[model samples]
Each structure stands twice: as structure tokens, then as C-alpha cells.
Target: MSRRLRRLPAIVLPLLLATTLVACGDDDGSDSGSGSTDALHGITITGDVGKEPEVEWDGELKVDKTATEVVTEGDGEKVAEGDQVSAHIWIGNGTTQEKAYSTYDQKQPESVQASNDLSPVFKDAIIDRTIGSRIAVTATAADAFGEAGNAQMGIGNKDTVLLIVDLMDKQVVLDGPEGKEQPAPSWAPGLITEGDKVTGLDFSKAPEPDRKLQSATLIQGEGDVVKKGQTITVNYLGQVYGGKKPFDESYSSAPASFAIGVGQVVSGWDKTLVGAKVGSRMIIALPPAWGYGKDGNPDAGIKGTDTLYFVVDILAAS
Candidate 1:
């Protein structure tokens, strides 16, 4: 699902200007006496093979290269044309070792994966690379995400990045019954049961395929079933059906609150919960159409066309 986002922070322009100034003033093998903008394009990169990459092949886990490292290594397995892989990765500056973005920082080392070849930053390089292999990919600031990239990532104009990745597993897409079936998982408060799973009680309709629609159900409060513009709070956990593997959860620290039917939630939730009364617990089983869709999370090892389940607890509506 796509939703237009808020504008970039006002300070982004200032960061871009500062990076330009720093690039112009550097005299250490950078910049020409001439005033051409081409100097900004001269970024050099180098790296060490942190340690030999550990590798094993079970036929399922195959890479082009059996032996791989950072500076010099083997080209791991060839990622099948459409296969998606999951990985654990750490990124930093290849020259100075300054840590940039890291999966460790999010405390979500396994859930971060990439599947797209275009626009997605992590795609292309790691796609087609075998499991448990390591590669150092270098991209220009222009090649990254650009100005928003610099402000959001804190990378400088001439900065070079080194991404150290560990391939974990590859995900396979399932069609029809081939998909795993999940029984209901353990439930917390305000949950109701239809089958083995618990669901939110506020919605009036079940899920619909290939269309967008809104339905509402009531819980405890008195108001129009979550009106179009009202702000609301909800708690939800996203899990793979049949496997009980949770991909995302908002129940760890506090229940999540957002505007009803807004882009704050995925299109599936927005369409399903518009009329749901607050305090009603509902369950949603979403095929890939309502979930991550065809481009599954390869980095987290999710395949395209996978089914997903969610348990939602409505905490507040405003």
C-alpha cells in the first residue's frame, strides 16, 4: 500500500549546504582548482574481509561463492531469478569504520530484509547472493536516496559506505493450499475467537479481495463507529499464518494510536477498521494482497504472495 508522507524536516536544506561547504574546503586529494561540480563525484572506497564468512550448503542454502570475505572473497550462490533471502547486516564507512545504519540499532536483527530491485536501497546487490555470504557494496550519495538520504542517514557528500551482510534463509512463495495454515495463536486482553484465532469485535464485515472498502463494529464507547476523521489508538501484531512467526508487533511498549482510516495504518487495516467501534478486538487474515504483496521481505526472508495474520486490540479513539 502506498501513502504520501509528510514533507522532509526543515533542517534538511541546512545539512545539504553544510556538506557542500565541507566538500569545497577539503584539500586532501579532493577537489580540482576548477569550480566544476564534478569533484563531488570522486569518492574512494576500500575494506577488509572482517573475518572469513562461514558457509554451508544444504541445497536449499546455496550461493555462487563458497568462500567469501569483505575485501576479497568468493561470489556466493546465484540468487534464483525471483527468490527472496533474509539477512542480518551491519553497515559503516569502509575507510574510517564509522558506523552508519545498523540492524542492531533497531534491536530487530532478523526482521530487516529487502526484495525489490529498484528504488529499494538494499535490493540488487544482495539479491541473487547466496545465504551466509558477505559482500561490501559501495554507492554514491546520489545512488543512495539523495538529500533526504543525507539528512535521514547522516552520510556526507563524499562518504563511502560498507555493508556487511550475513545471508540467513531464503523464502518461497506458495500458491493456494501450498501456503501454510495457522491455528489461532495465544491471545491477550479484549480478544474474541472465531476459529483458533482471536479477532477485534468492532468490524461488521470480513476481508474482501481485490477491492478497498470500509466497515465498522462497536465496542464500549458511544459514537459513530470510528468516524472518518477521528483519531484512534490500536494495538496489533503481524504474524505469518501456520508458522507462528511474528513479523511486526505494536504491543511491546504501548498500544499504537493513529487517525482512523488514515495512511497511519496499512490499506488493509484502513479499509477494514473504519467503522469498528473502539475497544472491540478483531482478527484479520490477510493474503499477500493485503500484506507485503508480491515483493516480500527477502532480507527478513519473506517470500512474495505469503499470507499474514494479525491480532488487534483497540485501546482508544479520539
Candidate 2:
């Protein structure tokens, strides 16, 4: 699943850097409810609601305890505690003035739940926030990850960590495409049987490849037409033209969600899926020029002259 077709630049950093923990005894130094705005004193953030941001601070910033601040007030729906918050996140080592993690690099947001199991620093940052809100959380390395700190991320035990979160909309993911069924073209790829809806594609009867981009809708949805710059959720399967084996598919796993028509995906997907309505099911073909170009995604076992064929089910968009 970790392939170039899903993400050209593969950088998926977790909200918290993971490390094994060994409990020696009961510790009373928990960061929950130990929130304050003292850490935001000299920190400055600049960016729009749905874009990556810039964080700057004077001197060496330090956080003895976890702190939280609302940089921008959003007028969207309130997210109840324990509910999932789908957000684009960025984290930097304030002590080192170095960037550590960001979802913005992949143009994708991940759904994070703010429960007691989550780090107390993160719970304070995400709980009870409204969609479209911009928030900042600062903490000592111990409160953020653990006392050991994340050595791989260049964070030390005494370093301060700054995290910025843009609360994106509640992600809408579907098992499969659901909409009005329509007749498919004769030359289009056929579906493989399962219990009901499926993403397994069959290209046995498909014709030879061509030098053009083409698409055909198999199901017409009643939802809003997808627009450029919208982050879309979809279950898709892709194959090299005339090949029986698929290069990629999301049939049994979680749906992929990313910004569309903004170069987050290949040109073929941006062009064909932007104008499509949510819940629509379509099959598309992308010649090398519209697909991987001359490189042809060598990592995906595709050649320089191959065309990529895909069957996509548009689940939702925001």
C-alpha cells in the first residue's frame, strides 16, 4: 500500500513519534489538564485555513508543561470529545528550530481521535475543537512523546515541541461507491464479483491502448460535483493497460483521501475526478503523457510507454 501511485512523495509521519515504554512504577506527572498558553508567548504562525503554515519563535523556546492556544477561531461544527478529528498536522522541534512531521507534504489529512488513550498533550490540542479551526500545542519532549524523547526525529529530552493542527472536515469514507447504476461501455473494464459492490477490475476484454485520456461513468451520484482543490476520498484500483495484474487497489483496505486537481495525484485523476459527483463510480484510462509520463512509475513495474487504467469510486469530498 505504500507506493508512488498513492503518493508521489511518501512522507507519512505520525502525530506522535512511537517508542516502547517500560513502567517502573506509578507516576503522578501526567500532562492532562495541565494546559496553559505560556508556551505561545514568542511563537508566531502564518498561513491560510487549508494550507501549510510557517512557525517562528525568538530565542530558545521551552515548555515545562503542555500548553494549548487557539490561533484562529473557526465557525464550523463543534467536535465533541471522544469524536474523531480529521486534521492536517505539522510538528517542529522548537528547541532545534527543525521541522519533524507534517501531513501537508502528502496533501492528505489523517483522522485522529482525542481519547484518553491519546497523549495528554494531543488531547489538550484536539479536544472540543471546531472544524476549520487552527490550533497550536506546545510541550516538553516528555509530555509530547516520552521521557526518552524521539532520537530519530532529533528531539532530546529537554527540547520543546510545537504542533499546529488545522481541523479539516469530518472524513466521509464508504465501503464502496453507492449511487445510481448505469450502463458501462463495451470497451470499459469489467467488475469482478464479490458479495455486492467491488473494486476488483477485469481488463480481459478491453481493447488495445491509445494515446488519449478517456473516462466513463458507471454510476451517477446525486451529491455535489467534485471541484478543484477539494480533498476527495475514494476506493480505487489501477492496472497497466492490457495487464491482468493490478498495480494498486484499495478494495479491502481503507479509502485514500487527498487533495485533488492540485497536483496531489497524477494528471489523469485530477482531470477525470474533479468534475465527477460524490458517490459516482467511473473507469478511466491515462496514456503515458497523462499518467506517469516518460518515467512511467518504474517503481510500480510500469514501463515508459504504458497507459494506466483505473476504476474509481468517489466516496466523498470536502
Candidate 3:
């Protein structure tokens, strides 16, 4: 199992939104409506869409197999194969009728590659559904976690799982030609690049920390400007001001993908990278107020008063 599958609690096992690819098995030929007779029969979900839903089950609820039902129809674009989907999910343990996980608590919905490694029940319920649709579905242990049930969530091999999903948005991932590189701004951190690879950074003339966010485009791109709420792929290098070496960079590994403007990352990244065009490289400077606040990220060796610097290459956005 991938780290995404292994680390997440079983309730939100399907909520792994990381960019890494995982191999999935073919469907076992179970009908989407196999358990429709009992679907949504004893269950009730009430609340505004896109927010935490109130779930209640009248009595003992059980499903012998997999099933799906639409709780509310949507009027947006219908989902299709290969679309990167974003959704708010709520899961409950059918046997115990206890709430398991809700993305609403995180304040940000998750985005995943539709039809990729997802349970057949989830794919069937979500595919062809329009954005804004609210759906309820049931999955038998075999349909969900299989023989190795999750012991942490008290789900046994025979336990059934219930899910409520709100289709928030979807986008078709598109590939575009790289944009032409432009000259770096005079005030930006000095950078040495060799055909899109940053080889060296110079901060000798960098400004002193002032607890404010600052940004300068080193290489302007011609592609569409990235917008808030869109998922983007980027390669970046980061370091604390006055550090001997960069703290992190995506060049040595896979490019990072995350939804912008949703606080998925630090506020500095959301503010500086949202409007940058694909193929562009920008340098961002973040003060304590926007970098990590008073409690800096200890694991990264960032301190409460440390200023952070980043040079980011915007690769793709959707």
C-alpha cells in the first residue's frame, strides 16, 4: 500500500489526494445498485452543502454489498474520466453508526485523480455526476478494505462502510507549451539558472526582514495566469534567510502538486504564487507573520523570527 493509503484512517482511506500514482485493481463486477434496497433507508444527512453535514441513522444499518444513491442532484458540468476531481467527503462506520472522517473539519476539500485507485463504489457513484451533487453510498468489507480490515477504526473484515460525498469541482488536466523566460527583476534574489534548473542563489543584497511578504518574478511566462483555488504543479527551492544551503527543493524529487488559495500551504505561497503564469519562475520572501507565525516549523529548522526565501517554477495549473 502507498503511504497515502496506509497513513490515512480507514474512514477516509479513499481521501488520499497526494500526487503520487498508485496501481489499482479492476472492479470485481459488483453492480452499482446491488444494495440499493437498503441504501439511504435508515440514514439522514442534513446541513448546507460544502459544510460539515449532520449524519444520523435511525436504527441498525447494514448493507450486504455495495450500493449508491444520489442525495441531491447537481447542475454543473458532469464528471468524466481523467478529470481531476475535488470533493468534500464524510464517512461513517455502518456497523457502529459513528462518524469517521469529514473533510469539512479540515476546512479544505480534497482533490484526487478520478477513477485512479478509488473504490469501485466511489467511482461509480461519482462518475457522470455533475459538480455540486451530493451522493450516499455503501461498501461491503470486500468492496472497501478487503480481508485486511483497518483495526485502528475498529473495522473488521465483515464491516460495512458508508460514505457521503459532495462533488465540489473538476478540471481536465491540460498540457501546454512552455512559456518564454523573461529577465529577472533587479530587486529579486540573484539566481543562476541553466535551462530551467536553478544552480545557485545569491542573497548578499537581499533586504532585511520586515515582517511583510514580498515577491519578484525572475522569469515571466506567457501561459495563462494561475488563479486561486486551482491545483498547480511546481518545482521549488526554499531556504531560510542567511542559511548556508537551501532547506528544500522539488528538483531532486517529483514536482509538487497542491491546490492554491485554500491554505494548503503557508499564506506566503498562496499570496505570491496564485497569479504567476505557468513556466514562470518567481522568488518569494516571507517574514515571520506569513512564513510560520510565532511557532515556526521546527522540523524544517525555521525559527519564529526567521525569514524564508523560495524560487518557484510554475509547471502546470488547472
Candidate 4:
């Protein structure tokens, strides 16, 4: 669950006013309603949206809705009362041109329910929103983001917020073990012969010490050639090269399935797993650039410059 901090209404009002003045240029002709069509003047993209954005606050603010324009987009399946939904959202300052927040942080698209905590506006805005429908909303600092408005996001008090929300799909979560973690796979007791081959790597090697993110070999599994976009599963363990021990690991035999080449995995996994084959045992050395950046896992005693090692197995591919 995401951490939500609600600001006091008193503290919020002054910040909201400051952000509005700085971002919206006097607010001389702005509307008062949170759903005003003419709230935003324009929108722009500052960087490549295809990559994992370093910051989400670079998209320009653009609002072009007529007075009669309704927020509904006739695209997604009708959102039932308790349906599950996921989205790629972008929030921007209409006047300052700064981005405020987004869900692009998710390696995969984020999943949310129709609960109040997911998004206050989504419950009402998405009732009629169809799949693939694009919706844009312009709301005042208070109306859109409640008391924790754009001021906290670095905007002035009166700054209108432009929210370009994409309602991707509505899904029903299976109530059983589909969402549960799979059990670990057992290691083959016998020696891994030619049957153990690399799954996706055209080449494999030991990672150099202090390397950012390099591929490592798994001790078991057949190294069959794997292709991009294929889903694969494997069990693995991660450790700091010279530190205590494996602080993270997958189920022993149950490898996780993920779409390769896509941003589904971390930057290192996507960069190194290009042509690896299945049934292969490999090790990887990950540098801070390829691993977690400055914010190392304090609990694991991994520092910014520390390298990581992983013994991975390519058990199965889809």
C-alpha cells in the first residue's frame, strides 16, 4: 500500500495559494470549480516518456474542454462497484510546467481497486470510463489533491492541477491462489550436464568486482535459447558480493516469469538478459547504476558503491 499523509486544512490553504500564484500567473481568469473545462491552458512533454522517468513533473499542463464537456470517456468496460483497475497517471502544474506525481515508478503498471484510498476522483470519474479511454481533469489544488496539494509538489498556492489519467483496464481478481506466491522449485539432485544451458544469453561470464549490473550463471537448468517477449520463470538468490549473505531470494525452484526486453524487470535484468537461453545457470554482478542507485537497501547493509551478485536459473519459459 502507498503511504498517504493528509495535510491540515490550515497549512494547506497558504501553500495552495502560493503554488497557485507561482504556477498559474495571477489566476485572473481561472474557474473556481475543480472540474472546470477551461482550467488549463496547454500541455508539453519535456523528456522521453518511453523510459522510466527520473521525475514525473516535466509534462506540461494542457486543458481544452468545452463547458459541456463531461469527464467520461467511452472506452473501458463499465467499472463495477468493486472492480479492480490499473492506470498510468500523469499530474502536472498548469502554470509552472512542473510535473507533480505519476505512477511510472511501477516496473509494471500499478494495480488499484475502486476503494476510496486508490484515488478519490477515480471512483466517480471512472464509473463510465471505458477501456483505452483517455481522460483529462483540471482541478484546483484543494479539489484535485485534497490538502496535500501542489504546494507540496513545489507549486504555488493557487496553481491548478492538470491530471491526464489513462484508464487502461478493469479486471476481476481471482479469489484463489492466482495472486499468492508460488512454492519454491527443488534443485535437481544429480549433476547438471549439457541439459544445463543458458536460456537468454548469447554470451555469459563472471561479473567483475565493482561492476554495476552484469549477467551471472546459474548452477543448474538447461541452457536453451530464449527469445525476447517470452515469459520465463526461475528461482534465484541475491547477495552483496562481500557482505553477510543472501538478503533476497526467490522460491528455490519456482522462477518468476517476466516479459523480457520490456521494463518488466529492473534495468540490469532488461539490459543483460537479452539473448540468454533457458536451463542455464549464470551469475550477475550489479553496480549501483544498474542496481539501486544512492538509496541502497539499508536493511541489507548495501551501500551506494557496493556490488551485488546473483545466481540465477532459467527453469521455464512461456
Model 4 residue 236 lDDT score: 54
lDDT-sorted candidate list, best first: 2, 3, 4, 1
**What's the lDDT for residue 218 in model 2?**
91
10 residues in a row with least lDDT, candidate 3: 1-10
Taking all chains together, the TM-score of candidate 4 against the true structure is 0.41
Worst 10 residues of 1 by lDDT: 1-10
Q: Can you write out model 3's per-residue Cα lDDT over 6-34, one digit (the tens) per residue? A: 11232333323231123233456445533
lDDT of 4 by residue, 121-229 (tens): 4444444456565555565555455445555566554566666556666643322111112222221111122333221221123223645345544333334555665
lDDT of 2 by residue, 115-202 (tens): 5555666665566778888888777777776777767677887898888889987655555667889998866777875654464667
Clashes of each: 26, 0, 0, 57
For each candidate in turn, the TM-score is 0.36, 0.72, 0.61, 0.41
lDDT of 1 by residue, 134-246 (tens): 45444444334443335345665455444456555554321111112233322211234444233332222323232222222322333236666444555566655444345
Scored by lDDT, model 1 comes in at 0.41
Which run of 10 residues does model 2 get worst, by summed lDDT? 18-27
After TM-score superposition, the amount by which residue 200's alpha carbon in candidate 4 deviates from its true location, in angstroms, is 26
